[model samples]
Each structure stands twice: as C-alpha cells, then as structure tokens.
Target: MTARPPTVRERRLAGELRRLRESTTALNLEEAAEGLGWSKTKLSRIENAIRKVTAAEVQQMLALYSVTGPRLDALVRFSRTTRQRGWWDVYENSLPTDYATYMGLEAESEWLNSYTMGLVHGLMQTEDYTHHVARSILMRFSPASEVERRVAARMARQRAWTERADPTRLWTILDETALQRVIGGPEVMRAQCRRIIELTEQPNVMFQIMPLAAGGHPGVVGSFAILGFPERFTPNVVYVENMTSALYVEDEREVHTYALAFEQMAAMALSPEESVAMLERLARQ
Candidate 1:
C-alpha cells in the first residue's frame, strides 16, 4: 500500500524523462498531462520518481517528446532495470534511507575516488575495525542488535571491491592521521594495516597516504567520495558524510569541485609504492 522509494536507476530514468519533456516538448506540467491524457498527479509522481514506470509507458512518453534512435532505445532498456531489486534491499528496513541509497549506488559504480580524513573507507575496513567504529559512534543511541546489523551491512558492502567478478576500481587517499589513530588497539591496527597492504596489491586497488607534512590542502575541510558509473546517463555522484547524516551532490559544478579537490589531494599524497611501504612500517609498530 505504500509507494516504493526510487532506486538509483529509477531516479536516473525519471530525471531523463523530465529533461526530455521539458527540453524537447517545452510543455508545462498541466499541458503535458493533458496531452498525455493523464491526470496531472500521475505525471508529477512519475517525474518525481515516486511511481514505477513501465517500458510501454516510457515508449509512449518518448514518442510524445519526439525522441528517436539510440537515445530512445537506451531509455527503454534502462526502464526495465528501474524495478530490479538490489541485494541491499533486504537490509533497507534496518538501514537509513540515505545510507541504503548510497549502498545501491556503490554497488553499481564502476569506479570510486575516496579521500578519508579520519578513518579507513568502509569498502576497505576489516571486520574488527568496522565493529569498533560502528560501536563507538552508534552504541550511545542504538541498541546492540541494531549496531550489529549496521556492522553486517558494512561488511557486506565490502563485496563491491572484493567478491565481485569484475571488482570496482578503488583509489583512496588517506590522511596520515587516519593511519596514526589506532582504531581498535595495536593488534587491530596492525591487522587493519596488513589488510590494506594486501588489498593494495590487487590490480584494481590504488592507495595513497596524505602525509602530515602536506600541511594544508583542499581535503583539509573533510572527506568525500566520488562514484563513477559505466553508463553516461547515470552521472557521477559525490558523497559527503558527517556524524549523523550524509549528502549526495549530483550537480555538475558541485561534483566537479569535489573531483578536482580529489585530484589535487592525490597529487599531494604519497605514491602507491610509498604508501604501501608506510602501511608496512605502521603494521610493524
């Protein structure tokens, strides 16, 4: 009885549909609805991604907007995936809406560019580190079981880089403080460092350390990640998180700002070989 929340695919399809209608037809909402012989509310809901659209419906709308050729075929093909459920769907009820949405996007991303100021990225975290981090922040307000659920979800998220047949390419620039701050204690940090070192050996993984000597840089403000997808229609998303909630930046200019910042930080950070040496040295200490 409740409307389903839009998945990343649905949101992409909806945005494209709205763009086409506005740019091509140049019709106002009421007029568009009248032309489609549908109630204004129905069109509104579809455009807002509150309702699922059928492939047939997509064709009809494309026809109305005078869309033809490859773009039309692509949209119709994309519409079929709008209703497909992701593995993360099972944990949706337990996870925050924004976090769940992030998981969905991460799973489908072809590559990731991450800059971390205080901790290891979730996709690269060891189970012990994940448990410690989850409990430290969540235990004050969340029940132990809920905390465990979150931990499980995080661990599952690692599959994007680990278990997949074609693993997502990951490039992370970690602040030196993140390496120095012993998360779960000496032993845990050692194991975590070892884990990171091992992952860096993989062809798809790239790790860099922004040494303390770097002094000041654009990333000094905070940490963020940019998710790039294989398809052009599904634009890159920049994810920024704080203590309680997260923000997804999709505007071209805003995402470009984050991307540029990441590139600048990457230049300031240690090279991949040097970073692995630093990890190995830390693991010993």
Candidate 2:
C-alpha cells in the first residue's frame, strides 16, 4: 500500500514516540516490538504515525519503555486530546484531506499573512460570493445539495477571522483584479467589497491592494498564506493551494521564502487607507 503523509496528530504522536525510542539506546525496533508483544509493522506504524495511537496504546508502550513521572503524564494527556474534534470534523468525509488539514491548521492559527493575485482569500469571502464560486466550480460534478453543504462549510471557516474572543490577526494583500472581477454579479460584488471595507475597521484585520500598474510581481506566480501559531514550539507554516491539491511547507527555509514573497507583495500594494478607498470605489462602480 502507498504510504500517505501523516496528519497533524499523527506527526505529533510519531515525534514523541520516536524520541522515546531513540532515548533508549538498547531498544531497537525489533527488540521494542518483541518486548511489547506487538508486531514490528504495528510498532513501525505507530512510530511513523501511519496509524492511530490511542491513550491505552501509548500507556502500554510507555510502560514497556520505562517512562515514568511527569513526562509520562504529559504524553498521556496529549494522547487523550488527540481524539478531540475540531469544528470541521463534520465535513471530514466531504472535504479533501488536504483542505481539511488546512482548515484544522487555520483554526489554530494566531496570525495569517495571505497574498492573492486574482481572487479574495477564503477567510475573507462573503457567503454570497462563496456560494456563487462554489456553485460554478462544483455544479458540474457535485449535486446542488452537496454544493450548499460545501458553501456552509466555507462560511464556517470565517469564524477564525471574525470571532473577537480570540481573533486571528489577518493581513491580506489582493491584486486589483480581484476587486474589479464581478464574482456574483454587480450587486454581490458591491456587498462583497463593502464587507471587505467593514472588515478593515477591525484592529486585527489588515488589507492592501496591488494595483494593476504593479504589473508582474513575485505573487504573480500564485497565491499562498503564512500561518503563525501562538505556541512557541509550533513553527509557522506556509500553505499553497493548486487546482487539485495543496502544499504545506513547515521547513524554516521554505517558509522564509514565502514570507519574503509576501513582504515584497505587501510593499508594492496600496496602503491600508488606500485599499479601503479602492474597495469603496469598486463597490460603487
């Protein structure tokens, strides 16, 4: 069977497990599996995060590996929380794995830096625009009911930027073409642009427009987002989406590349005040 990449939970579990395994120099994979009375494949899967690692399983492995005290307690606690579900859990089977992962990460993000060349970023989209776009893209293959469900899911993602109790700072840079494009017709575009204007009023939100004259910039290649987490240990991620799949770059070097691109794009875009004025003018047009 083809091995797929580990999900967030899997990666966390695997990292901890691998650390534990390496700490005991005498404990090789075969020896560890034999001592735990488990198959080598099971041990490998658990270590690689190719399979679910339950609290009970973790307890057994920790006990066999001679783990004790606060460290064991912390690992067990982490194991328990891994089973917890996020808001997007309901759409697990509906959304692609990559998209689902993106939502999960976005939900935990403390800050987001996004650059879009031709479309409004997902977190900033209005319901009408979301519906129109989803319908146009999905109507060919998905039923109307399914398309509506997807739209609802998309709208739900907006909570990351809207919930003031724990607001996620969003810095979005859009190409002027995105504002001029009539997504759901003039009325919908008007409301959409107006919504963007209103969103700019929030302290946690920022907007910039790359004018038509800022022709051929680094972001002209595509769109992407750099998501930062509050936890110091959780490294920032750069997420890039294509027509069929998405890429998550966690390595510091690659993430830095995306960060530099966003900085350059933001530099060329209109100032916050200018962007709001641009939106207002587009809405009226």
Candidate 3:
C-alpha cells in the first residue's frame, strides 16, 4: 500500500507543533526527545509531517511545550482530523505523488487563482477533452484502462467546484491559444468552450482570456496556480507542473511572486464579460 501524503491540515498541525516547541521551550531536538521519552527520529518525523501524530501524542507534545488555554484546545481538536481520508485517496495508486498532493490541497482551498498556457484547467475540462488530452500525454503503449482512470480522477476533482455547498472560488486566466488549439477536433473544442462559458455563470467562478494579442507577459514563463486556504495558519501554496513532475511553492516570498504574476496576467487578460463573448463566438463557429 502507498503511504498517504500529508494533507493541508496535517501539515498545518505539524507546523504549529514545531513552532510551539521552539517558541515555548528551551529544549533542543535531542533534549526535547529525551523530555518526551521518545527517540529523536520520532519527534522529527512528527514535526516534518512524515508520520501521523495521534491526538494523545499531540497532547503530550503540547504539555511539554507548555501550551495551554484555547490554543491548546484548538490544536488538540485539529490533530484528530489529520488522519481522515480524502475521496482522492482511492486513486492514489494511479496518480503521481505530487499530483495527488495538489489534489489534497485543492480540496481544502477556499479559492484558487490559475493561469493555463497549454490546455484547459483540469477543473474546467470537458470529459471528452480530458479523454483526448490524457491519451495524448500518457506514455505510448499505455493501456486504455490507465487512460480511463486518469479521466475519472480528473472528473472527480471537478466536484469541488460543482457539488460542494460552498464551492471553491476559482479565478482562471486561460491563454487564447488554449481556445485556438483544436484539442479533440472541432466538435470537442466547441463543447469545451461552451463548458467554460457555462461554468463562468456560477457565482464563485471567474474566467478571463489572455489574448494572443497581449503578446509576451509574466505568465509567458509557464503555467501555475496559487491556492488559498480558509484557515489563517494554512499558508497559500503555489503549484507549478511540467511534463513529469510538479513543484509546490510554500515560501512566503516565492508565493508572493507567483501571486503578483497572476495579478499582472489577470490585468492584461480580457474581462469576464469579454471572455465569455469570445467563448460564445467560438462555440458558434
């Protein structure tokens, strides 16, 4: 069985535990491990979110760190939730580790800002478009079943925007080239355009088109997304993907840079109204 990747909540809990220990106690790693009566490696794994920390373990760590009051109560409560399984966990065997990690974060994000240069954003893709794109990108001679699994996983990821009561707010700036490219031929592309326009009608969805005429821009570097969580302790994450791997940017400075680039791209892109108009035209053509 594959080891589960750390969820956003778990990562946040781990960070808080480390912070409390460092700020409240004079003990170093070795001393803290001795105080807690555990090996240094155990404490180290907990702090790094490499191992799940039980509620009892959390309480022990908090006690050693001298944490008390409402903060203590909240951390204890949060720790219990760290081990809950996500819907995407079932597909872990098929999905890349980093992609699975991104899905976990996406599920918890309150909002997402994405810029796409090559294809439609996964959350906004049509099933047929996804089928074609998946087949094209998967390794040659890959079985049909593998391609179908990927399509299903991508579709499942869309439910966060469609079925959730408080759907995640999405602000995506799609490059005009994505629309111009004939992914699954004319009919499929038309349906894909219509799908984007339909999704934009939802109150929480925002779509803009970065026109080819806009020429070179900051997003010209590559495609990326920034995800913001509801909890203040959970910092924003910037996700960048290439052919084989993905990068998650959590540093405050680096996340800020991606945020700024997204803002600039949004500014240069067509307004929501205009983007919809363009989509309408393409859907008709």
Candidate 4:
C-alpha cells in the first residue's frame, strides 16, 4: 500500500522532533537509531513525517535527546494533539487529497488572505452559485452524485465564515472581471453578488476589486491564498491551485513572494468601501 501523505499536524511534529535531534551534538541518526533499537529507515520516516510518531515514541526520543521538564511535557502534548482529528477528516475520501489538506489547513487558520482572477472565492460563494459552478465544471466527467458530494463538501468548508466566535479574518482581492462574469445565469449571479455585498458588512471580512481599468497586475497569472495560524511557531503557507492539483508553499522565501504579490494586488484594487459600492451597483444591473 502507498504511504499516506502526512497531515499538517504530523508535518509540524516531525519538524520539531528533527530539530530536537539535530540540536544535540552527541546524537546522529545512526547513533540515535542504535540507541533506540530502531532501524535508520524507521527513524528517518518519523523525522520526515512519512509515518505518525506516537506519544510514547516522542517521549522515548526526547528522553534519549536529554530533553526534560516543561519542554518535554510540551512535545509530548504536541504528539497527542497531532493525532486529534479536525472536522475536515470526514470528507477526506470525498475530496482530492491535496484539496482535503487545504480544507484542513483553512479550518485551523486564524486569518486568510486570498486573491482570485475568476469566479467568486469558495468561502464567499452562495449555494446556488456553488452548485451551478460545480456542475458546469465537473458534470462532463463526474457523476451527479459525486458532483453533489463535492459541492456539499465545498459548502462545509465555508464554516469559518460564521461558526467561530471570533470568525476567521478574511481579506480577499478579486479581479473586477470576476464580478462581471455570470456563472449561473442572471438570477444566480445577481444573488451571488448580493451575498458578497452582505458579507462585506461582517467585521471579519474584507473584499476589494482590482478593476480592469487598473490594467495588468501580478494576480493576472492566477490566484492564491496565504493562511496564518494562531500558533506563533507555525509559519504561514501559500496555496496555489491549478487545473487538477494544488501547491502548498511553506518555505519562507516562496511564501514571501506570494505575500508581496498579494500586497501589490491589494494596493491596485479599489478600497473595501468602494468595492462594496461596486458590488451593489453590479447587483442592481
């Protein structure tokens, strides 16, 4: 069987464990494996997050590395926390593996910054718009049942919009053409625009339109989202989607590139208040 890709938690745990082992001058992978009585391959898998490391295993390794006191307790807690499932786990089999991981990260994120050149962002799409868009894109090859399942899963991912007491702060910059494109006919498009208008009133949401008149922009190539977690230690990630797959950029340098691009787009886009006025005007038309 193929090994499952590590979840976000597993990756984080793996990074910390690897850091701990490397920080010790006396320990090397071969020496550590011998001391733990595990093969180098097994130890490598744990460090790379190809396999889930148990709490017991974490304690054993940390102890071997001479980690103790509150630091040891914290690592042990992280091991257990990594095993806890989030709401996104239910749809793991239904969604593409990469998309499922995106949803998982989105769910855990405290803030999101997104830019889109076409279609409304999924987090802000209406049910009618979502259903129509999903059918249009997938109906040719996907079964109706499967398409519906996909649509449902997409809707569920929007929970961050309202479910949390302190809702996830979302800042999105949309290409003006996205507002002009009619995805599900006039009525559906009208409702969709209105939905976004309503969302603008929310304290945690901000939307801006990069008008066509503004001419070419960095976001012209495609769209991406930069997700920030509440935990200070977890660095931000940039997510870029393509036809059938997505790329998650975790390296500080690459994510910085996307971040700068988004800032440029935001600067070129109309202000939030002006964008709302534009949305309302378009909805009326």
Best by TM-score: 1
TM per model? 0.91, 0.79, 0.88, 0.85
Which sections of candidate 2 miss by over 4 Å? Answer: 1-44, 54-80
What range of 10 consecutive residues in model 3 has the weakest lDDT sum?
1-10
Compared with the true structure, what per-residue lDDT tens digits does model 2 show for residues 228-272?
A: 976543568888998789987866788899898888888888999
Stronger candidate by lDDT (2 vs 3): 3
lDDT of candidate 3 over 43-89, digit per residue (tens): 99999888889999999998998888877787888888887778877
Candidate 4 displacement at residue 277 in angstroms: 0.6
Instruction: Extract clashing residue pairs from model 1.
Output: none
Scored by CA lDDT, what does every candidate get?
0.88, 0.81, 0.88, 0.85
Rate residue 143 of model 2 by lDDT.
Answer: 86
Write out the backbone clash pairs for model 4: none
Ranking by lDDT: 3, 1, 4, 2
Candidate 1 regions off by >4 Å? 19-35, 63-67
Q: Per-residue CA lDDT of candidate 4, range 102-211, in tens?
A: 88888888999999889899999999898888888785688888778878887888864588787789999988888788887898888988999988899889999999
Model 4 lDDT-worst window of ten: 1-10
For residue 136, what is the lDDT in candidate 1? Answer: 87
Per-residue error at 220 for model 2, in Å?
Answer: 1.2
Q: How close is candidate 4 to the true structure, as a TM-score?
A: 0.85
Q: What is the lDDT of residue 39 in candidate 2?
A: 96
